[model samples]
Target chain A: MSNWVLKGLQSGVVTTRYPRKEEKAQGISPGFPDIDSQGGDINGREEDVCPTAALYGDSNSLKLDKGRCIHCFRCVRNTGHPVSWTSGFEWASFTEKGTPFPKIFQKSLYIRVVDSGDCGACLNEVKLLNNPLYNMHRLGLFITPTPRQADILLIVGPVTDHMKTALRKTYDAMPEPKRVMAVGSCALTGGIFSSGFTSGSGVSSLIPVDIEIPGCPPPPLAVLHGLLTLAGRTK
Target chain B: MKLQETVNQMQSRWNTELKIDLDLSAGTAVVHCERNTVPPLCGWLFNTMEYHFTGLVPEEGTEEWKLIYFFTGEADLGSIQVQTSAPLNEETFQSVSPIVHAVDWHEREAEDLFGLVFEGHPRLGDFVLHDDAWQEGLAPMRSGFDSDLAHSQRKPKSNWKPRKVLDAPGAFVMPIGPVFSGEAESSHFLLETIGEEIVRALPRLFFKYRGVEKLAEGKSIHDALLLSERFAGTTAFSHALTFCTAAEKLSGGQIPERAELLRIFFAEMERFRHHIGIIEGICSSTGLVVAASQAGILEEKMLRLTGKLTGHRYFFGLAVPGGLSRDTDDEAIKEALKEIKGILHDLNTLEKLLKKTSSFLDRLEDVGIITPQQAQDFELAGPMARGSHFCNDVRKLLPYGMYPSLQFEVPCEREGDGYARLRIFFEEARQAAAFMNQAAAMIKPGPVYTPYSGGEGTALAGVETPGGASWQWLRVDKNNRITRYRIMPPSFANWHGFHLAVEKFAFQDFPIIKATLGLSVAENDR
Candidate 1:
């Protein structure tokens, strides 16, 4: 026991005082694009450079949907538009359906995130609530692993064929209070690799989505915020 | 690499344009074949080549379906992919589980998601999706399936139910979790244990199989990067790395030198912490306070370093489509390196002290001795495989990131036991520190990350994760949507080796043994 305590002490305190403090690690976390005042053609350039179409175009500026971004930085890094963001870890929400992103009417609204098809990272990020680091538990936001637990069932991928039953089952499991949320671009509109035989239409084709959070795998904080918005937990 | 040659040879055997793409920076060989040839390809890789089973990603869609097979050891990267696929209507194939015992759960998962019928598979019905609504001919993985059956014209579930357990001798079974309070994603393990020995174990996963692959369909190239990253929890970057590499190759994006360095840093950071966590879990299973404490410290330190460098502790949001997310500050990283150096020194002393402890050795030595032959037959990789007399590091076999520039030794043991695993962790931990020091000291600072540009076709990226070999095979259509994205993490291939080790051992050792296998249920659940 003495040895254990001593060993732990020697390693020093390893907790991150995020949320309360500005972290340098997440320069612009949640896959947020670094917005360096771009030239007049930045919007077109961002769109031209963007592979997943996560960058939304306004008459003036190109708004990036963090949720649908895979952190590729085609618009920000590769292109000279100079919009880039660092990693930000502080993401939480009032509910699993919340959206940390601001609502934009012309900016592709009303969506649901479906696992349409994805590996488990997007879901794992959703499940980080139990962990003390991103204590999403305090926000009353917990994932059901079933669409029944969701209102705006956030979809992650382009929807694989095998998961069709599972996704349908999840949607069936959910109550009437449900609204689908296309969390990543894959769910909202199908990012890259959308034309394959296994590829499915966007989440909108499968279910009625009320919201969308476009990103590759939105930052944990970003995800929390997204869920919170769905629960109307965002102040 | 030897894998490239094997891939070249395999191409002659297969003229179906199923060439595998290679991402040398990430260290993987991906063979994206058609759905029909998946089973045979898996058998070939497991039997002929040195590859072992990693996993199968069964992506469901409302209109289409795709099941991806991921393997490691000897594969082709930096080239075209060899693929063979079939429609969802014809979802029957030979069982690779027989050839690669590690692939049983993956096969079951595929059956659960896409409704793929594995001919000759013993326990193939409803491994994960337990709904009675599952129909024999109607596969779920198809892309045309309705996202919401309630709204669909299909009739509601009627006089149908899950098959009741048969009344056999000691056939009673107990189930545990898609909702269990634990780490990783949700999953259930149904075991028929007799007197503390598991007679049979069936995995009930897919509680969160959200058609991840299906979500990639029709999306732009950039959008698939996010889809690729979410394949698994612990190793998100590795998965996305493969996708990004493939996309980079297809699109013809240039990865700057500094971006490559940062990539190596994050990968090593992920590996260092994961190893510590696994080692700690092993110690806790054996009640080794000293070792566990040492490992816990290591874990925390590594995580903190991860934060200091990339922001997120788990290194999430680090790997972008082309390069890194954020450019790690040089001085800050230098300072972190100094602190990590101190921790490494302390770890060295502590690990040495642990070897002399009898209680620790008693639980580990020969406690699950898998002979070298057995290990090879089982096709083990990562630390577990290394502990069992096999040299299976994707980094060593295929130099990726800063590995080519850095010099290191991969520790292997003849005695395939828990003791060997522990010792190897220690040695590797030291080696990790050495590598980090070398990287930090010698690594020249420059532009960190680069975004991808899609032009021609899809590519492949493979990386050596802590679990062994993690792979990603991705293809983006002309419209920038994900045509196919498949992943295989190390844990998927190691399921059999762990089960084989447990066959003779008492149930009491289940926790430690399970921990040693370190297979992530969520990873295989996809």
Candidate 2:
């Protein structure tokens, strides 16, 4: 135990002061694409070259749904219109309010993370939220194993058929006035494996999603930001 | 060569009447034989010759079903491909699972996906697909059955069935989830326990099956590379590299030396992160939360390094057919190498602390033991196999890319227990750092992508993933589109080892055993 304490002392204060201070997550996020100065239409080149069909445009203007964008950067490289990357990690929010946050959950929140049918990318990122750098507990967010104690349900994956029942049961088990947050592109719009025979297009098909954090699998910091946003701790 | 002599002896033993076509470069001997001759050949290869039966691939087209068995032979003589045919309408083949136990799951998967009847095989039931997902006679993977049509005609059937409770006085069955606590992939474990000791463990998997193989069909190999990379997120590069290796072989392109080195660098980087992640799991399972979090810091740093090297965090879209899609800058690679050295030092320190902690060691030592014979019988791979003194590392035995020239050691342990697996993880992590250093030093500037020029054919490629050997076999058409693609991940081969490991242990030991194994359900269910 002495050795353990010595080691802990040696590795001093690795925790980040997020929500209190800006955590500059530069070069860490696979940032979203911003429409460049020359960008108006996708010009048909990016629409054809994109593997996930995340890009769609005619002759007028282009729009990027972060929910569908996987950040493959094929559009940025092969498109006629100039598109650049925007490196912002704080993209989480309580997107829609089915019910207001319960009065008891104002100070602290317990979140239950469910993998409906993820590829494990989003799951890994979510787990990274508990590391020293992103110490979620320090921000008053705790991961509860049981849904009975959860104030928020964080769902990942494309919501496959096999997990539909389990996901529903988990949501039903959570206390009332709870919020549902869907993380990653797969959870929002099924990313690549959309509405297939085996997988649901998105989690909203089964459960009401209040927040959507988007990326192929959003960065860990984005997940932290999402939890904090749900807890009303983010500006 | 010894392989040549063995082939000659096999030809003589088979009465020299069967026509055998040999491709020495690919190390495959194709014999056209009647379907009845398969069982005896498998018996000879597995029972008499002691060859490791790696996988079984069954393909269906209009009239016939093509069955191929992949096996690793003695020394680097190359893998042998056993081929036969059956009518697609009434497909029936003699089951090799009776003789070779490793292919039991393979044969069951074949039965599940292709509607092939494995005569005289035990437990050839639902493995990947649920019973209600398709019709009674139609299999989704066969070319004739449309997945959309199957989905439209779906009938929901209750999957719960009566279980045979063990006949002991106090023994009872306890079922854990298809959805469990924590951030794990969904799987169901039915533990037959008496008091706290588990009598038998039945793992009912396939809760995460998304039909990745079916999704890859008819898709361009370039596009299919994305699907293969997502087959498992943690071991993304190895899976994509294996798929790309097969695709490049089919398309006939030479990967640049620099690209090969880059692939090796990414692979070792993945290994480093995965090893650290497993150590974190071990620490957490043993109630060492501080150590686990410290290891998690190392893992997150590695993830950031990967995000810098490749555009995406999981290193997706970086590996494509022919070679890598983009190249890493020398300065960035230098920085990563320097960071890796520090990470290695921290891991060493953390490992030392854990080794001294009696509580952590007490839970891990001698908890889950798989004897050497059991490891061989089950065809275990990766650190799990190596812990039992089986040198199953594909990088050393079947060298690929820069592994042929790379200097590294395959760590093996004789204890074959939880502690042994932990030691192998530490040793392999150290060796992976050494390999990362060597790859960084040896990398040179060259073109990353090579254009494909060849026509259609089938090709096989295997890579040593962080877990074990992840093999891919792809068949392309003249238009360079994938007609069929089959993957056998390391977890598919080693999941059965969990059954053997969990036997006779207390229920509390479940977490540590599982953490040490670190099996991925997505890879296996795919």
- Tens-digit lDDT track of model 1 for B1-526: 6655676787888776575776665555567776557667777777777565555656544444555565656444322223345554566766767766667776776776566778878777655444443444345555555545622344324664334444566655656543332333345566665456666555555554445565566666555565566556467666666666666777666787777766666666666666666776777678776566566655655655665566445555567666776677788778877877777776677766676677667777767667788777766667778888787676765566667788877889888777887777777766766766677666676776565666655444667776777766566656666766666556666755565666556556666766666666556555
Error of 1 at B448 (Å): 4.2
**TM-score for chain B of each model, two decimals:** 0.81, 0.96
Instruction: Sort candidate 2 into its docking category.
Output: medium
Model 2, residue pairs in steric clash: none
Cα lDDT tens digits, model 2, B65-179, are 8898887775745566778887767788988878778888988898888888989898876567765444455667877766676656766455745265668888788888877
The model with the greatest TM-score is 2
Q: Report the lDDT of model 1 for residue B361.
A: 72
Q: What is the lDDT of residue B199 in candidate 1?
A: 60
Q: For each candidate, what's the DockQ?
A: 0.11, 0.56
Candidate 1 interface RMSD after superposing interface residues:
7.1
lDDT (C-alpha) at residue A226 in model 1: 66
